[model samples]
Target: MKHHDLEILITTRKFFACDAESTEEAVKIATTEARKHLGQDFYSLEIRDPSAGWPETVHEATNPEIT
Candidate 1:
């Protein structure tokens, strides 16, 4: 059997709703919340096989709720 080297990349996104006095504060609140939660929405995935000399394949999530 031949061994091959492959690479994988995953991208995710999360949304947070915050009520703050300013945009800066809202961003801060969202960041803090994101740090506390492990849940994320899948955005895209990429896979590459160097041995095959093939272009990477990309799969993107089509969920409208992600945004």
Candidate 2:
């Protein structure tokens, strides 16, 4: 069998409610929370092989009602 190495990219978006006094503080808190909960909220996925060229998107989640 042949083996290959590939890179995967995951895109996620989530909303967080924080008791912060400033926008900067809110962003910090949200970033911390998001890092702690990685891989739990993903809306898109992409894969690419270094040996190959550009990355290819495999999955994407879209909400028609939001637009």
Candidate 3:
């Protein structure tokens, strides 16, 4: 069987405070929390940087294209 990589994107509605020291840490925490909340099967996750003070953050998911 062939395997493909999956990507997941999570965006927050507002700027939330996090105890993480860096963006990577923050993303990891957010991803974990989101996964638990989502309760679904996923492969990989990517976190996007927030716009200066902007609540809207862009997240992207990539997966194998089906024909």
Best by lDDT: 3
Writing each residue's lDDT as its tens digit, candidate 1 over 1-67 gives 9999876545564435668896557655655554455346533333333334556332222335554
> lDDT for model 2, on a 0 to 1 scale?
0.48
Query: What clash count goes with each model?
Result: 0, 0, 0
Give candidate 3 regions above 4 Å deviation: 1-15, 41-46, 52-67
TM-score for each candidate, following the candidate numbering:
0.40, 0.48, 0.43
Please report, as a residue range, the 10-residue window in candidate 3 with the lowest summed lDDT: 58-67
Error of 3 at 3 (Å): 29
Q: What C-alpha lDDT do the candidate models reach, one value each?
A: 0.48, 0.48, 0.55
Evaluation by TM-score, superior candidate among 2 and 3: 2
* RMSD for each of the candidates: 15.5, 15.5, 8.6
Q: On residues 1-67, what C-alpha lDDT tens digit does candidate 3 reach at each position?
A: 9999976556444334678897667776777666565444444445556653544444544333421
Model 1 earns a TM-score of: 0.40
Worst 10 residues of 1 by lDDT: 42-51
Residue range 1-61, candidate 2, lDDT tens digits: 9999876655544445769896557556655655465545443322223233435332233
